[model samples]
Target: MTPPAVVEIDHRDPALQAAFCDYVPRVFRTVDFRRWCEWGEWNDDYRAFAVLDEGRVVANASVMRMRLRIEGREVIGYQLGAVGCVPSHRGRGLSRGVMSAALESCGEAPVLLFANKNVLGFYPRFGFKPWEQALFGAAFHAVPGGEPAPVLDLVEAHVREGLVSLSEEGLAVTERFGSRGHARIASWYAANAFSRPLRQLHADAWVFAGVENGTLYIDDIFAREPFDPRPHIPRLIDQPITAVHFGFTPERWWPWAGVAGEDSEAYLFVRNLGPPSGPHRFPVMART
Candidate 1:
């Protein structure tokens, strides 16, 4: 069989989000996608699409971003994800279908994504030219007495008590990066990424859940700051600490000298998802 034809879904739309909640599991359910949508986890800047065959989803793609209304003009920055084609349908046209749909929908809004160098090669065929590195590893330091405590209670308490301090800090960083043209990180959240933190399901929680392992110090904490990770050492090294680890963006956030400094780099991928102020600098996927 040629397989089912491709269909791009407007998953962001409320009706669609509700309609597809149950069916998403039959195809893709790595994260609690249905619950995320049910909890108001979406932005207009976010777009979700899929490829269907025989009326069932065989492929999917999602691009989540934030909208910046600068001087009355909307700037779109997107992070691509929720991408995969059913195994049985692999090597067919499903990947092409969903991928093409996602990129084309990006329009002239300047799409960006963090993917392995090998994967980056596949994007250009759709006009997703690489301008920088978006993927990176992260490091963490636990509080001594604090003992790199699990985010479970912390996340729960915050939600229970409206502990928006972290979110606020994260937002500040998001705003800073958004202003600097790194809008993809700050500007949006994909459903899978959104509800985790919203539910206080942090990297540490995931780690503790055996989803990963160890202290669950942290996993992927997307931020908008685009700042050096070194300065946070004092914060990372503060008293009540237990352990620290690094992954993703090693060069930038890792403790190379076991010391902290204000000057360091993090791994990231940047693209002009919107109008550019002028020339920009980004890493080539070849190096990532």
Candidate 2:
């Protein structure tokens, strides 16, 4: 007769963390929080509010503390993710309970999330407004003498270590809009997102890129120093024939002003943070 109580998942407790992990893939088929946790990148920044049904997570919502750069200013915000209620738990307002608890924990901090087409109308009930995202792109031509960038296997310890180092020491890839402390989320994508590879440009520079249908999508770059990645773009793909697009703001990496167009796939919703006046794309790797 009584509803299950929502509780905060304690990442410090392995059992609770495992329970949370088991519940996640049931909702998000592509995400693997367990693998990310095994890599030891899961930290206190990510907090989950959940409803437990006999030691198993049945409904959940989470908030990730983010160090974000918006309009050239550094500010702390929150990201909402891992939100769902199991099929058996649906229609009982369990999701609403957990979401309210998660937002309450965030107080007045800005929160953002990427929702799928199915849930397009669910978030607005919580005061989240849909924000438009732009894709920045330019023409591409492979350099005549370019060699393919070496792809690193993320399964290798050293390769993962290299990304960890760059994530900690590298300069901000963009000042327009992106995440700062995003190493953990980046690692999550590295592990679970199939086919996307980590390519080495310089000894200290690595990029999460993929080639599809003659187009190269540079999702995000990790570099230990300030450097132009344009020259190395040709090396990223051996047979590029179409355009190159950046998943984040490209002002710091490219010389030319790229053309901007609406990103239909970017279903971004925000609370407490006004959208930037100009075009911008949040780093693909930073989304939780």
Candidate 3:
């Protein structure tokens, strides 16, 4: 058997980067790292560590330098994503090599990752403990027979550029617990994963949302200015919604009706950060 070589991929090297992107879909079928990088959102903060067997990437972990706002305090942290090992390389401890490299590069900073269901048991070996995240919701009265908001195409050059600018200038969605400098990661989901329409309410405000089970789920709201999104909710409703659920923290934006429950869908695991005492939700849009 060939020895595994763990290396930090230089994304500027086209061939090595392409090999890394190729490895992503083989492990995580749904994500498109290639398109995300190609769309020009991949910034200098993101770095990929990979285990290469005979120069072919077989296991990988990618890290991003994060500026987090935890309980109104600015924290310099790290986020791990695009973590996976090809099926053929499983059980070979290849993931550990990449993870070690990735973590070492992060130094002593706090780190976090949202694990896939199958890998819930994997992160604990690296001193990561599962963390609970709160969900915020409120009763929403939508206008009956309301017109749908115009959808913004995220792939559009102007839209993408605008969001990148807003990400730097916008106020944190929640100082209680949110993120900073996260537009790059958010663009990946906007382009590939989001099935809902993204509606621009203002020159600087955009909302990504959809209706589900009479609930209007607002996945994310990007804005450069501080504005109340509540007033614009009526324009976003395509039908009558009984309630509104926010994916990102609304402490700075809305009067949330308290914690609805734990966000079970987010399999969050962290290292170095203590469990949040009060209700907290990591900004959904900021996650990688």
Candidate 4:
């Protein structure tokens, strides 16, 4: 049996750097490869590994950092992301090699990720456990007929007229919650939006500013203790919204169901990236 040649990659090493530069289009195409190449060059929290065959790159994966504050404690975790094996190496077990190496290194902080149900089934044998609610679909609220009301129009108008676009607005919103609310959203565009400016790198994300899908999905947003996502759902007493799919707490969400006929619920399969039985409080940012 030929042993797989798998080892951690130093992003700066010329050989491994060339491998990453080559695979961006095949593995992930949403963001330009240059950004990841830059990420490799700039970020210290990222780690990578490549599977080599007789001194040539065949597969690679990366471990990136995600910082979350849960229950008043600052939890800095490693997220297993940007994993892809070469087409020729698909059935060669190179994935397990890279995953095993990444899992072996996580010490104190728990590691996590979100994969489709089929992929989730593959991680458990490696000592990962499926943590419920570790994956959550949007807690949705159907607007009255799925159309933005006058108030929503005003909000869009603010951005369209390009009047309330400034970092000052974003700063004011940051105090409410980290970065997951409407206030923070408005602030995000005001500050990082390309057309506007506060932070440089995020300016490209501003296209989401004027985009009102007429649907609001609150996923890992303002997560409170016992994972109670019910009351946090904005109550629409007199308003006419079609439905609201509350998060994991479907029981508490019953009142919300009254707003619509039948709310759809979607959950993701979550598997831990640590020991056989470890802390399962892995945040939703695994998929973020």
Worst 10 residues of 4 by lDDT: 171-180
What does candidate 3's lDDT look like per residue over 1-288, in tens digits? 554678787657778888898898898887777877788777778888998777678999999998888877889999999898999979987888889889889888999999998889999999999988989999878764445567888788788887777777887777776787677777888767654677878778877788888898887777877887777787788677889998877877786557899999999999988765578888787887
Better of 1 and 3 by lDDT: 3
- lDDT of each residue in 100-121, candidate 4, tens digit only: 7776666556666545443556
Predicted structure with the largest lDDT when compared to the true one: 2
Better of 2 and 3 by TM-score: 3
Candidate numbers sorted by lDDT from highest down: 2, 3, 1, 4
TM-score of each: 0.51, 0.93, 0.93, 0.51
Model 3: weakest 10-residue lDDT segment is 141-150
Scored by CA lDDT, what does every candidate get? 0.42, 0.83, 0.82, 0.40
lDDT of 1 by residue, 35-98 (tens): 4444443446456677655555667777765443232354655556656666777887777777
Highest TM-score model number: 3
Number of backbone clashes in candidate 3: 0
TM-score of 4: 0.51
Model 2: lDDT of residue 143: 40
User: How does candidate 3 score on lDDT?
Assistant: 0.82
